[model samples]
Every structure is written in C-alpha cells, then in structure tokens.
Target: MNIIGGPAQDGEWPWQIALMWNNIYVCSAALLTPDWAVTTAQCVNQEASGYSILIGTNNLAEWSPNYQRQPVASVYKHPEYNTRIHDFDVALLRLTDPVEITDYSRTICIPTTDMSFEVGTTCYASGWGSSDGINEFLQEAQFSITSSNNCEGVTSNMLCADGIESSGACAGDEGGPLVSLVDTRWYLVGLTSKTTCGSGADVFTRMTAMYEWIAPILDGETPLSK
Candidate 1:
C-alpha cells in the first residue's frame, strides 16, 4: 500500500534514519529519540567524530536484526539556519548511546500546532536518496500539500510538496522524512528541504515552524535563544 511516489514496504518506515558519514550513507535522518535525531543542516557535514546512526533498516544492503548503529553525540543547528536561503533547514542529532526502541526502532510526530496543511494535503515522503545511488529499499513518496505559491524560493517557514517528474527527494535526500497522516497519527510535517527533482515544489522546514526550537531539544531542556 505504499504508492504515490513508491517503493517502501518492509516495516514501512520506522522513523527512517541512516545519516552515517564515514561509513558512508551521508544523509536522511528522523528517529526523534533513542537519543534524538532530526536532520538537515546541510547534513551536518563532518566532525561529530565519526557520525553514525543507521537504525532498524529497510536494507542498507540488508542485515537487519533491526540494524541499529548509533555514534554521534551532539550537532544542533537552527540558529536561524540560512545556508544561503534554505532558512532554518533544521538539525539535531545527539546520540552517542540510547539506540534500541523495539518494534523496529521509532519516534516521529512533532507538530504541536502551528497549522498549515490544507492546499491538498496528501503527504508522506521517505528517503534513501536515489539518482542511481543509495536506495536498495526505504523510499516512499506520495506528496500533495502544495501552494507556497508553487515554490521558487518558498518561505513562511516553508513546506511545499508536489512531485512528479523523476518522482521526488533526490541527491541523498538530505535530512529525509516529510510525513503527515494527522488524525490517525504520523506527523513530522516536512524536512527533506529543497528539491526540484522535476515537476517542481519540494522545500520543507516547517515542523510547526520549529516548535520553539524543538521542545527544549526534546526535553534535555535549553533551547530558546535567537
């Protein structure tokens, strides 16, 4: 039943993450707490000392005892986050320990309100990035929520969807995830940040306008400056 953009079915996204860096993988993160995670700050490039975070797995080549890697201890970013114009692209890693959630690892659902989800509202976008590279699994699509005036440097915290051409989420799909099921659960409203895979409109970075900089860094407390 994973249609719209396609390809994803074994365990269907358990908060999909894989941001490794020296072991490769390079981008796509979302497991909110087995030690926090939420990505895109230009994919936190280098220096969290070895970076890591594989977790559960939809096939990073296939291994699964529910995969699970771990190894990054700190890397917040969102002090305005304007890598050029991507504005608040979001970022938060912290996980040198805690990693073993159960039903195949989990955590996702951060939109305590700030609204915005009308235009068309279909949502659901996972990633393992593909343009002919990674992606042996983990890759859902089905976007819809459109009308940031149709993209073109979207703003207003940003959150546009609309996909088509070669599908969507490309180039290692930076900081993946863009969910939205609302009402039945599942809501991590956008994070793939920036795209033009073809049919236009992709931007994202409006997890309820950064929920006051992510609920005190998910309760470890202390976020509220800027």
Candidate 2:
C-alpha cells in the first residue's frame, strides 16, 4: 500500500474544486475565476461531454450532497496539447453559470509575469488523490512539497514535485493544483496534470509558460485559453 500524508486540514485555502464523473472521482482542480477553472486537458479530453464541476466545498463527502453542480459550458484544450509528448496538457473549463466565491469557493491567485519557481525550491500540492495506495471513489486532499527538478530529461513545461516521505498525488489526482507560496500569498504555479499512478513525483502543467494563453480567457476577452 502507498502511505502518504494526511488529508488537508481545515481552513487551508478552501477554494479547491472536485471534478466528478460516473464512479470515477478525481481531486483535480483549482478555481481560477468565478466562471473558469484550471485543470488538465486530459481530465476532460475523453469525456468532455459528461463531466460536472462541483464547486463550493472543501469537504468532498458533502460535495455531491450539499454543493451546487454546474454543467460545463465549454472546455478549452490547449491547441498544442499532445498526449503523446504530454505537451500542453493544460485546459480551462467555463462553467455555465458563475459560481459565487464564498469562503469555501474563492479564486486562486495566478502568478504574475515576474514570478518564477526554480529547482529544489519547495512548493505545496493538494488534492483528493489516493491515500495508503487505496483508491476510493471519494476525494481527499493531501499536501506535498515540490520535487528537485521539473522533469529534467523531459520537456520544459512539465513541473515535478516529490512527497516529503511517502506522500504525493496518485492516479485519480490529476488536474489539481500545484501551488507555490510567494511573498506570503499562494500563486497557482502549476496544474496537477499527471503522475505515475502511485507514490511518485506528480507532474503538473507550469502556469508560467501558459500565461499568455490563459490570460485572455480569465479576462473574458477570449473564448479559449489557446
């Protein structure tokens, strides 16, 4: 069994969102705007038509039972996203209606053009990924620091993060948030794109490289993040 960190404690950035489909649930997503969410393109790639965005809840158990279920109005996959190379695997989803950001549903701060994370620098990742190597249908959030490098042999856009011990994202944790604390505020540096499906380094799509593409969408100036 894969042993990992404990679930997210109360009141630590409660703006996370849970993406649900059928019996498969992925703790992958972060609220980017009142009407938009930042996650992995692959999360919506196969079944874009059937996914629902559950917002306004830190507690996954209460998500479906208590929170509002918003239909995905549109999905914007990066034009260059290639599953083969895993390049540009980032995507944004526009909700049919704007979700009111409460204490439990706030928009995450995106990094400014000047901010950049380096290798060996510590960052935090949270999601309803697996715990104890057991895959549950429910979602649970855990934390992990950034890895040493952003996939050294792989492409530059891929960011890496290792668990402090046996803690990290797993198979069902894709399309979540890989955040970095800069100047006391947490910036959405990466989107949890993929991992090895067990206790291993989790990969994310670097937000820095995709700023230009994502900016217009967040600002409502463009219909897509491409």
Candidate 3:
C-alpha cells in the first residue's frame, strides 16, 4: 500500500480495516458488512494461521477501548481471480464476530448498480502502509479518475486513477479501498489492485465490473465458497 499522505483522523473513514497476518499489519481492507470485509485475493492468498482483522481505530501501535480485533472465520477469494495478472482481485472475509456498529466502525456501500464511476470523479484512497516505511497511523490521498488508456495493462475490469500532484504515498497499499463520495454517502468504487506508486497511476479492480460475482455472495451464503 502506497500511502504517501497525511495521517487520517479516527472515524474519518470508518469502513477502513487493518488486515493482519500473524498479528502484523499487512494490507488494508474495507468493511463490507457487519460480518464481512472485502480485500484483494492477493491478500487472502498470503494468509496464515494468525489472520485477523483490526477495526475501529486509525492507529495500529495502540489498542484502544474502541479497538476490536476479530479472528477471520473464513476467506472467500473470487473463483476467477487470476494470480498471474491479478484479475478479479477481490476476496470476501467472514469475521468470527460481527463488528459492532459505531462511529469508528461501519460499512461502506459497494457498487452494485448499473452505473459507472465516470472519468474525473474525485476519489480517495486510504491505507496504513508506507511508501518508504511503515506508518503507525492510517493515511490517505486524493485521486482523480483518469482514462484507463493512460496506463498499460489496463483491462476491461479495471479503472485507473492519477494521484493529485502534491499528495499520494505508498508503501504496501495492497487491498486498500478507493472510495468516492456520492450524495453524502461514500461508496467503495475500487480496490487497490496495481500501481506505479511514485507517479500515482493506480490500477484498481473496478467494483462495478464485479457486481455479478459479488452480488450473489453478499446476498446469501453461497453453497460453496473458497
């Protein structure tokens, strides 16, 4: 996650999640529902016995009263996810316990409608990773939707964004959320799939393109899931 930006305040991005592997912060995630979180399949594939989720706090160095750490009950990587190219890069995480709703912990809306996050729409990408070193607190940067054509390897299932000049940072932003505000509510429009960190050409798994694969998983428990 390339988080070359300012530290985020508590509750600024409540849906944000800190993905843990062996108790160490690895990548970021988004709370999809009280019981479910969303991240990249790449992140899931790196899982080990210590997999867990850290919610309700912006800082990872300290465990506060609002902090809640839950073990991951299960992981569901998309069936069509491609490790070679990272296509269909999302994965759903089932938490052992539902995260209690609070100002510091909540879920964000995912794109599931016949809509497009048109070019030029402003969006924000947040994470706790560093471009140079690990950050103790969450950080964020703003980006503007750019034509996918600007970046090579852009695919039909991806959307591209260019970081604003004065901002943008990255250390290990894998599986972070790229969200946009629409009519007062923030929607998760993309997942950090790929990036050329320094120049800010981010390639994200466009959530809209995965509605078919995601809608079903979100509606009811699938009979068979990874």
Candidate 4:
C-alpha cells in the first residue's frame, strides 16, 4: 500500500500484515499476537480456508530473513456488524500457527479502556495499499484524531481523522491498524473502516468501544471460536 506521500521504513511497522485471499491481496491486518490479529468484519467476508497471512517484511518482493506465512485457523466477526452503516466493523483472526515475535516482527498493544486519546492526538495508519492502487511496500500516513461531530457520518464508536491532501489510506488499507504512540508503546486505537485517500476525513472503528466484544475473545472464549 502506498502512504500516498512515501514508503515506510524497514521494520518500522512490525505489526503490519499483508492479507491474501486465494493468493491475491485483499486487505490489511494488525498483529495483536503471534497467533491472533484484528481487522474489519468486512474484510473477513470469505472462507478461512482461502486466507493467508504474510508477516515480518515491509517489502513483499524482498523477503526479510524472518518473514513467515501462515493460514487462518478461524475468524470471528462482530455479530452486530452492519455492512450498510459500517458499524461495529471489527473481526478477530486466529492464525493456524503462531509466528516468532521478534524485533523484526511483533504485535501492537491494544488500547485499554482507561487510556484516552484527545481529539487532536496524532496517530498513524499504515498499509500496502496505494492511493493509485495496491503496492508491494508498506506505507503510512499521519493524522490527528478528529471529533465524531466533525463528520456527519461518524459515530461515537468510530474515530475521524482529517487527511492531509496526500497523507491517508486508499484502495488497500481496510482492516489495517490506526495507532498512536503512547509513552514507549504503540497502541492500536482503531481498525480502518474505509479510505478517503487523504482528500478528506478517514474513518476507523474504535478499538476501545469494541473491547467488550473483544475481551472474551482475546481471553480465548467466543461462540464463534467453535
């Protein structure tokens, strides 16, 4: 995915992932753990058998020595997800096998309930999707979290970020991570719901708002886990 403005540094986005369905890039995902990831429900629309997760590399063509590929064991989309409104658009993924979490490959911390981000806090959205189309390298854009009222379509459960003309998600960034650096850790704040390509406001499903549905699953218990 192209950052619209430029490319991401090697290992800069260790938690970024390239998700494929039938060997073709479909969406972006964030590594919450070696065996688990988070994305948008809209992205998990197909069967798990055809899904593939690629990790540990910024450039798809140039495989980083520690790069790994794994199949999806299971997927759980939010029961309340509404496609028309794009509400509650979160999903949890179980990797067939856990990857080795290292400096070159790692997980992004999930935002806790108590952590609060202000309306003007700076955050980032990264993916392999470019403004023109899909690309081989990872790309990122910086945005200041805006208020829900700033956009007519945004709700309290979603976050809005006004994109600078050439700095936002596009064609392939859906289900990717929207993170903010908190102290020394990068906390995943949201999952991309859609891309505005940086011309306007970008949308995301707020992670903290979905914590109740995600907590039990992260604890390894969910009706869909069956």
RMSD per prediction, one decimal?
A: 14.7, 3.3, 1.9, 2.0
lDDT of 3 by residue, 1-226 (tens): 4565578888998998999988888888999888888898888763435789998898888865787788898887888788888888888888888999998898999887587799999999988766676678888889888998876788888888888874553657888999999998899999988867656578888998877776765776641344
lDDT of 1 at 216: 86
Worst 10 residues of 3 by lDDT: 217-226
lDDT order, best first, reads: 3, 4, 1, 2
* 9: Cα error in model 4, Å: 1.6
Clashes of each: 0, 3, 12, 4
State TM-scores per candidate: 0.34, 0.82, 0.93, 0.93
- Please give the range of 10 consecutive residues that has the lowest summed lDDT in model 2: 133-142
| Model 1: per-residue Cα lDDT over 32-51, one tens digit each | 76788888888885358888
Model 3 lDDT on a 0 to 1 scale: 0.82
Q: Per-residue lDDT for 159-219 in model 4, tens only?
A: 8876655577787889998899998999998888877776667889998888777777567
Q: How many backbone collisions does model 3 have?
A: 12
- 59, model 1: CA deviation in Å? 8.8
Better of 2 and 4 by lDDT: 4
Backbone clashes counted, model 4: 4
Name the top lDDT candidate: 3
Q: For model 2, what is the C-alpha lDDT against the true structure?
A: 0.67
lDDT of each: 0.78, 0.67, 0.82, 0.81
